[model samples]
Target chain A: MPTKAMFLMIKQMLQRPFTNPFPVKHAPKDVTSLVEKIQKGEVKIHPPVPVPEGFRGKLHYDPERCIGCRLCITVCPANAMEWIPELRKIRHYVSRCMFCALCVDVCPGKKFPGEEKAVKALSMSDEFLIADYDKYSDNLIEEPPEAKEKGI
Target chain B: MAKTTYYIPVGPIHPALKEPIRVEAEVEGEKIVKVDVKRGFAHRGIEYMGMKRNAIQTLYLSERICGICSISHPYAFVIGSEKALGIEAPPRAQYIRTIIAELERIHSHILWLGVIAHEIGFDPLLFWTWKGREKVLDILEAITGNRINYAMYMIGGVRRDLKESHIKALRDMITYYWEFTEHMKEVFLSDPVYKARTRGVAQLSKEMALKLNVVGPTARAAGIRMDVRQDIPYDAYADMDVKAIVPQDIVGEARGDAYDITMVRLYEIEQSLDIIEFCLDNLPEGKILAIPNYVALLNKIKKTEGEAIGAHEAPRGEVIHYLKYDGTRDGPAVWKVIAPSYNNINSWAPLLLGAEVADIPVVVAYIDPCMCCNDRVAVVEDSSGRLLDYSYLHKKAVEKTRKLEKELGVRR
Candidate 1:
């Protein structure tokens, strides 16, 4: 085993005789100020141009553009999207959505404006805080009451 | 008649394991003759879910793989996809990623230290380690806005940025952590019982560690000289000079045992502090995200095809993510995640064999198994529907009393 006596002597010599006689330091600033500054300015809330490619925002389902394709209903992992056979449209419950964005990306119809584009159309509100479970689920659909009513 | 070997199944659901793993031990007398481990109880088919979701959605799902390793999985996936798509995150984002990753490492290593101490019946060390670990979590919460799951890393870049205030908070934390490290070193190195319990126990030879494909601290303990950060640099590791830790060479040559492994992890914590300080001092400024032209991004993503493997040195060990994209609307992710636990879990076999029954818990705890993020210990019941004797319970209580006395400044 290594000798501790020599190391202890060295450590004692190196040690400061007293703790630093400094006053208690004040709490530091929150780090999010930098992000807040960047996200603060308002640009176009939602551009009319087709949703930018590779954007994973909220999902949009246009009933008018529905081709009655059941592809999305089958692929929803959280089982959030349901096909209403009678209405020939998909009803998505915001409660179970994992926001995996499978339904919006896989939707075959280009009928009405794409849901991905519609989501991008919604302004980037600083409401990233999802307090209630319902609000998080609601994020999957663009028409959640929390979102604006500009889109038709 | 020949003596029959008794097989006892510890858990697919038991108090001892955090996740659901069933250990079937064949015992003759108190000696375990054979052992088999079975898992998959907590497997929620995350890979299949990832396939079903688009690339963007899968990011959130990947973060949920392990609560403790929340940032690493997403960071690996994002970096992998970004590499596949040929995009670079902003300089500031890179620094933020590095900071968060180190913070995660600090919390994870401290937590593991506490558990290891607990397993060895040293409750005071466990308490002190965990108490110190809280400082790391507090720093994490201040930076990422969440304690366990930071959710800061995005595909193109990061969602949050560090302000001047954040830097000040971090500086304060570093000071406290420095003080804590001095205390930890004293306890770990000077404590007679800790040395007695850990030294020469659960010995993993270098050859066996290499053969088993062990990763992380477990392999490091055995002097394997493998760390993904040092070996294959990713994120900010390439930018910074990363060094892999080994057993103390100044003291003597490597012994390749449990004590050496513990020492490696403790020393690595100091190294992580160095890396964090370097990253903070060199904080860069720029846009956090790459705003590619929508048309170009979509067209490129639509046509993108191929597979790439991204590996990160997570707190436990190397976490490898295999991603494949086949020009589908889902935008490239037939994703397969292999956590560090996968490699570390198998190593338990070699270490646990030929060890005493009392040493089993400590040896197993050393691996720092996740148990699939579920670690509730269940009450053991006998065949007659009666609770087993609580002999270990009394011992634990006495241990707790001793710990309290130490904390209260009472000499035992």
Candidate 2:
């Protein structure tokens, strides 16, 4: 056996665990009440390592700014977004989204020189915890209360 | 007296096999006489889906072909699409792509090493190697914004720019990985048990490798100097000098077994670090993306109707994407993606023959077979007069899934 690896292994044994003690550090006495505690602000949460910059996570769409151009629907690979002509907005399926952020890049919302306003309305948010059981739920789509623009 | 023969079906799903490759091995006692391989379990048919979407949309589909070599498909697809459009990605974009691709190779090789070590029952080495691999993944996540399906490649160029911060990160990453390589050498290379389990076992002759038409490290391990980066030289590889790492270069001779593959892969991880460093040092400063707007890119693809083949050197081997676009269609009229594992799968027949039943996992892992890519490739094989079609394979896969579900229920 090499002296170096042995020493290193020994050092590792003496030190704290390399892995994060996630649940072991924070598990409440009663397991089912953990959710209730979190909701009631009785339990503090430990966040994961901070996400990187430009990390494609949850979808965030601005209805007022959106032109309903259908560029996002046209470009989504996973068929995650659908153009609803009646609503004059796009319907996004968060469950189906690949988090590719192609729609974010393609959206023509950013202002250019001599341009009056930003037209491309869709963008991505850093909120990644968006998974849910129901695929067609209120959380998935961006059905804003106001800003109902007529179809151009 | 006739020798007793037993046929063992390893998987459509087995604990030993990582992917859904069914290996029907004809074993006489402990020695494998002949092995028949059947795929088509993980075929999601992204290529067929690519045809339904626009060219820009298809790039995302290409990225999902195999999670391991995720960038390779999009790299080839974009190159082919660019060739078809008669536009070139700026020098800055090419160099950035080169950086990402090399980084991808680093992670892939390290991942493969960990898997191979696990297969050989070297659990300590597996954990140790994977620990080293996490650094690469962190850098990748930092650079491209995602870990696996990077979505870094745009049609004409890369989506993200390698900023000053990214350059500093790359430099630090190179330094960290270079030191990690030294530790890896001390741990894995000097171990006699690793050498015994790997060396001389499942030795593929140079002639057999040539006959099998293997690519990537497997080909290099067999003394065949075949590398797509050296031959085709897409991205910044065309501009920079790349030295192909063969088994002989490291271990003094080509054994073309598990050990040589391991050596070739380990060496490749070092080479990738060198390439990344080179790219950062000589990186051209400009815009990251070639196409100004998304529709402008779509318009170019919409107008152009031509055929072009793009090849990328994935960590496993060569990935070729052939795109045929008819001007009228929203997407490519025909999109054919041939991943490296598709070519490398053919060598398994010769490699597995005469090997002991125990060596099956190592032999299979030697090819670093990505069945998700292979499943897309439909092979019609005729055994004597019996022909196996898509329907037959489909039925077999469905039956296996149902059986598994039933087995789960019974266990519950």
Candidate 3:
């Protein structure tokens, strides 16, 4: 047992630290300035720990493909999906989402006679850095994918 | 003149306690003379919340009942729900469910080992054990989307299929834990300091364990030959011969102390690894879900009228869920849960009665207690700060029901 401990000691000594430092990496006065510095290759921001494939993080919605079946609403344990009867769509409150991914499971992705759509309308993206000052911020909302083209 | 005795209240809040529970102990010269354990500080009304939702939603909600054994509540809930609805998960699905549950058990047991070590002020051991535990958690995340609150278990089957990559990860993890547990035995079982702190601490007897009705590993530590998997088998467990792990079988006599508990948990980790390996080798190929359609599943639950009890051997102990469907609502008409900590808590007062003051944390941590899992019902206190007894609360409940009926112009 002590031999194992010795091996672990040497191994950890050579390995990079497993945990983040107290303040974390690369804090600056402004995010815009930090982005500029990174773009110019003057600074290198360290990457965080690698998440596994198919990680459940923030909610991502494909409104164009959405059929509005409301099955996601029925199975969402957190009540994070709000039904808009007039719009016939669901509005998500990311602050209330527990990231359980149950809504994504119940999503009725587009299907033709022979082939199924590759992706569901609602899915879990890898973007987990979703902390924001506004709980109802525009960034947190699942804006329509066509908003840029149609200027909605 | 020397004082005869001193009264000390260890909780609702204390340094040693990780959760909210009150234990009042009277001590005379470091020897506890009497003890009283007062719980009901951590109830969240999760069962009540579950009953208000549809069956599938309630299934995921039950997974949040305990933070450590996240899979245990949902296992029991799905088992009970499937029984009430008369739906059987595919054979492959049953094996997959067993795999995930065993993975959770390995992780939970390691977590408890770290917690108990930290309680005893062995910080290095805590760090090392948790570091080793990260392997299992990583595999769990790879297989089930998230590390905790997996949201992976459906009513009749599991949500995700175990891919080839996932099985490879699990097999590697099983090997890692097999070696990890051996080192744990050296550190926790045979170490002189660990044994000194825990050898005679929280000692319980076989008769006392049976009388208290404790379930899970806490009862097993006292050499009780009972386990939910072994007694009332379900799913893949129905086929496997899972015998309970008792301390007396390993050691000559059953001291049923904290040291024995450490040993029991460490061995159980190997047992879980065996279960996982068995599942991986025997995993059948077929559809993973009996009723893959969520809408169809909820509709079936609405039309079903039945009641069933499901029990599972969680890392801490047995978690049992009672569900009833009245053929009216999609969710359970009534939902009741009996977490192992509720029954294991019965031994606290008796064990702490004669224990030394220093042994408080030892006794408390030995149970691997989950306050949130146990305290499903809240304690009622009146405005004047008087404790309301059971009958008074029952009368108040009835009055409220009658008041609601009158207000709504509905008569019973």
Candidate 4:
């Protein structure tokens, strides 16, 4: 117990703090660069460029290449992916995606592709920031602008 | 029924359990005679997903298992994949991995300290600890692009490379953290209230801790010096000076208990700080990742069929990932994630059985049970035959938000 107390006291006495005098002094090494990066707009918040080669990016869906399988929606942990019945396509809201990449891995078409290159890929992007909440709602379901105009 | 004791089941969904876990506490006149833990609430069938996803995809999926120890999970998984493929990360990549892992340990231990303080009703200590933790998080956000899921670990190696500026940042953090340690020590260790509450509260004997095969700080607290980093010597740990903090010898004396365990953690943070500094100073220069050639790597992975166990000492405890792969794309993995909480959970019975009710939260939090990860075993059921609507309870709690807002003078 005496040793423990001594250890504590020594630790307290000997330890030198590294906290910066915030707003007066420059930020700590990590924070300084972070502030610089943010100021330079280097860290993209919205739809950022995806890192290459097997990087899990934003959910990509090709309406033309659709086999209309709901495997992606069923496996989504965050329930971000939903199948649009009217347009016969799968739509994903970026806000709802947990980036778990369950959909990308589970896509069977990638396993047995017959032509059209199995239209699903996740390109890495840093654009995670959502500027407009309503835009997400707009992209929630797939419907062509012409389809809405024709009312067919 | 021969006069069965009244059972009060406490979770599957309860505020006390961080993730949805249930506890059946059998009590007679305020004395808990028997306690059963139920889990499986937050199990996202991660192993099943691992089986379906390719090796690279599994890296990100494994990270989502728990938000707190996110880095450790993927680190273990990626290392396992690397072993299966017989690929070694470059020297610089290995150093980066070590630095990031230690940074994670610092963040996680600090967070646990805060949570423990909050659970024990020491609000001020909790606030102060979290405030200090932000420094570590700031470092994390800078080093890795994101604050939470770092996405740094890749299959062959890591994705990001450390710049000279990054090294300087780490050095700066070490200095700041050393100073912050004094404040943490004063508030958490020296404070009379904290010591009185935690000192002998959750006493687990060294023999019992060993018998349970407990890993990490819990085992270390009980005088068992076992750290995977020291034992296995993976990545840059093989080159670095890694020391395990044992409670039996702190300044050449034996002091073992909950408080001693807490002290062990505090000291371990200092040790980690030193390791991070050493890694930065001696960081070898090399490629961040092995050159990307999918076909050859895929074929190599397919040809290798064996099992390897990768264990990492996470902030919570020793995390072991046992991987069995038969060379193929999307190979079957019998992944057994033995988190620190698993070993410490049983120890809780001995710790909390005879303690006061106020001591329950503290004792439970001390183990830092990743209940979300461990909720696969037990289920708690309310015996009233009338199920409690947890959402309704949440609604009631949310209703008080307005009053809390008014208290904060939002309307004014």
Candidate 5:
């Protein structure tokens, strides 16, 4: 028994617990009412710990910059991206995405023929908590409308 | 007349065990006479999955084999794949891989410490140890982007690079963690309760450990000087000073008990931190990822035909991946994964044979069995022994808990 450990144990006993009581200061008896109260601004929930830079999370698609190369479709580990030849675009099913971000790395950040700067058509955003009951829910997929005309 | 022996089966489904593994013990009045371990419930056929996919795809599949040792599987797989392809990762890439591997070890050993403490009915130490582990997870999440399944490895090199900020974060973390190790040593070595519960229980002699071929901390606890990192230096361990921490080095003698296992892992956590710091200081500058384009790497693998074995010292023990690539096939012709638990399973019989029923959880946890990695293991019980189901094992485990609770007067 080191004296430091004894002092540290005593300090821990006297101090507050390390875990945060999230959703509210105290746990609510019922979760549904707590949510309702949160929606009504009657309860203030603690924000989650901030994610660091370059965090791989939800898919953020920019169809305007896409060349329709389907490089992302080929490299995605989860087959999360679906090629839409009819629309000359790709649709991402976020639910199936493994969040490995290999597609993001493979997608060419090349500048277009006349463009001055390079832009990535597919990228991952920090907004990760995208859980939903419906797999086909619109919010769960990322299919930004193509900025170019259908026949460009 | 011979004394009548009672047969008791535990798990393949029990509250204490997270994975599906059954241990049948033939007992005589709470004293275990013989023990047999069974597996085969949690098999997802990961090796078969690896054989059906290309090397590029199988790398990610390997990551999914064991959530705890996720980094280790891919690390070994890439090494084997690289050997077959005849391409070596750059100096920088190797150092980055080493950093990630050691960080994985810190998180894993700390996680196991909490689990082993919990099994011994000490929840305070479990909670405190987990608090210490969060710092390691933060460093991991900062570098690899995910805490558990870090998808950080590629065939030629690692997927992510360490920036100056990442290096600073790692340095700060290692400095803080060095202080925490002292606290861990005191708690694990000096706490009378931890000593009383673990110290001479589930002894696996050095000779028995060598005979059974147990690797990693379990073997190290028994004073066997065997560590894959030191035996065959892989990645950046070739550059760093790799030392095997055995129980004899710390506690004067190798008792081959649960306490020694705890000491071995605690010492390992400290060693891992030191390795991480050394890698950061001596990190060579070059491209973090090799084969800038995926298509080129894929095509290269398509033309290569060879078989290679990659062995990595995972936090648990040693994980070996054997891959046979055929030029014309989409994936390897044959893929076999030998996880550490596959080798450590043999020791369970000897450790549990003569132990009391109350100590079943601690003894089983002593091996740190990762059945999820070695999915298709089986038990070899006596042919005449009858089988038992889940409910019977659950009731027995519950009874043990009740006995402890009553003895401690926690329950009315």
Candidate 6:
């Protein structure tokens, strides 16, 4: 039986490793130069595993489709949503968000004028690389267009 | 000359342990003469937080209690909550819930197998096992959108409906695990080295397992056919006949050792695969949620006033959740979770009493102990060997506060 295990291990040695070694397939010296090469399409980068449909990740809040019902605020388990009372829009903190997408589900998503597609106010984007040094960093917060318009 | 003894404290943080749990073993040579397990390190006060939130928030919060048993906890929570609210998930949703729960079980059991292998210094086996485990996790990701905290289960029903592609993926996963479990049984059960390491180690008698109130595979390995699924069926489990897999069925005698547990877990994976297969065969057609409207469901929860206990046979053991809804709040007024590790950890002290130092990791890991929910009150023992009660602790706390106040020259 141990022989079977050994054979399995030996077979594994001959076979390609199952895991997808992301970013780069092998280690590289002068990583910034490698990135430059990658940017110039001089070197091929190993791709990360493809995520499935409905993968919960960094959220995208559509300001145009938002009704500002505050239901997402009420349903968000992490309490990551703060209401901008003047604009009647909610600001979402990505660092605090657990990515359960309960907020996305409770959004009562709608279609805006001249748009055929129904867009949920809150939706999950595939962009998972949204980490930042500060919890309240601009990258982590979803500020509505109204706030941007007022520059407040 | 008489033998000398050494006091070995195995952890608040040890490589053998995954979580913070202190095991004090008085070793007389290699054999342990005494053992004491001190827990309560990882308490999150989640119940208090749950009581403060609305029902929907609390539901997702329940799923966060444990990473591996994410489905199990929410399964129990929703079952209890639905009982309290008199809401029944439709037939299709129930079937889907069963499928997801079984997928989790398959992944969890394989994970434990890998963990036990890693504990025994079998790195290749751990790697091999975990590599196989990726399939189930992928299928889980495809189905629930997330791998670990699958925010799928709702009080009335599930959030997402299983698509045809999802079902196809699950079937492929089931086929993959079938052969994988067969290989596991061959690699683990028949391997002389594995047997040498695990045989007769962490042996729990049926009597001892019952006395300790052990649930899930640990108790089942000890030859006790106690499973919440078999005893008190819930959701789709009620529609199917589920039986507890014990070591006796495979080996003709139950050793109740770490090896036997390995056997039990292996067989349980097969069982889970069968359950998933059955769920797929009998897949019903209908809406996923009983109350499709979230606000309406919360409103129904707000008007509901009742109490119920929900128990799910998790991969580790039975996860029980007691919920009391008092009409005023949308969430349960009182929420208490009983993770299987709470009872499963009880066997460790007894099992370790006469175990060798080499057998320590096996004994510690046999129950697949999760210390997260085992936390309640921490007992402080004085150096003089007196167990300080809460009142005495409170008195000492007050004294310390006053002492700090005096030192700072500040008064309230």
Q: What DockQ does each listed candidate score?
A: 0.04, 0.51, 0.45, 0.07, 0.37, 0.74
Best by TM-score: 6
- Tens digits of per-residue lDDT for model 6, B1-412: 9989899887798876678889888999899999898888787889989999998999888887885778999999989988888888999999999988988898999899999998898888999999999999898888899888989998888999999998888888888888988899999988888989999999999999889999889999999998999999998899889998888888799989999999999988998999999999999998999998889888888888999998888889998899999999788899998999999999988888888888888888888888875674356789998999989889989999999999999978
Better of 5 and 6 by TM-score: 6
At residue B370, candidate 5 shows an lDDT of: 88
Q: Please give the CA lDDT of all the candidate structures.
A: 0.70, 0.82, 0.85, 0.71, 0.84, 0.88
4 versus 5: better lDDT goes to: 5
| TM-scores, each model vs. reference | 0.69, 0.90, 0.89, 0.72, 0.89, 0.93
lDDT score for residue A113 of model 1: 53
Give a tens-digit lDDT track for model 1, residues A1-152. 44342344356557654322322133326535534643685321322323222323334555655666666665455677665655556666555655444455446564345446422211222223334645434454533232234222
How many clashing pairs does model 2 include? 2
Backbone clash count for every predicted candidate, in the order shown = 10, 2, 1, 22, 1, 0
Model 5 ranges off by over 4 Å: A1-8, A109-114, A144-152, B1-6, B376-412
* lDDT for each residue of candidate 2 in B231-314, tens digit (9 for 90 to 100): 888889987778789978776888888888888888888989888888888899888777869887787788888989999999
For model 4, how does the per-residue alpha-carbon lDDT over B303-336 read when each residue is reduced to its tens digit?
7787777778888887777777776654435665
Model 6's interface RMSD: 0.9
Better of 1 and 3 by lDDT: 3
Interface RMSD score of candidate 1: 11.5
| Runs in model 2 lying further than 4 Å from the true structure | A1-15, A20-29, A110-120, A146-152, B379-412
Q: What fraction of the native interface does candidate 1 get right in terms of contacts?
A: 0.02
lDDT of 3 by residue, B1-412 (tens): 9679888987898876778999888899999998889999888888889889888778878888887788999999999888888999999899999999999988889999988888888776777788888888888888887888788888888989999999888888888888889888876887777778998889988898889888788888889888888999988888788888988888877778898888888889988888888889989999999999888888898898999998888888888899999999999999999999999888888888878878888888888889989998876788999989989989999999999999999966
lDDT of 1 by residue, B121-190 (tens): 8675676678678778777776765566666776677776787878998888878887777667777766
TM-score of chain A of 2: 0.77
State the lDDT of candidate 5 residue by residue for B1-412, as single tens digits. 7998999877878877798889989999889998888778788877776677667677888888886877989988988888877879988999999999999899889888889888988777788889999998888898888777888899999888898999999999898889888888888788887888998898999999989999889899999988989998988999877989998888699988999999999899989988988898899998876787887887877888998999999998989989888888746788888899888888888888889998888988887888888774333334678665567767978999999999999956
The residue-level lDDT of candidate 1 at B243 comes to 71
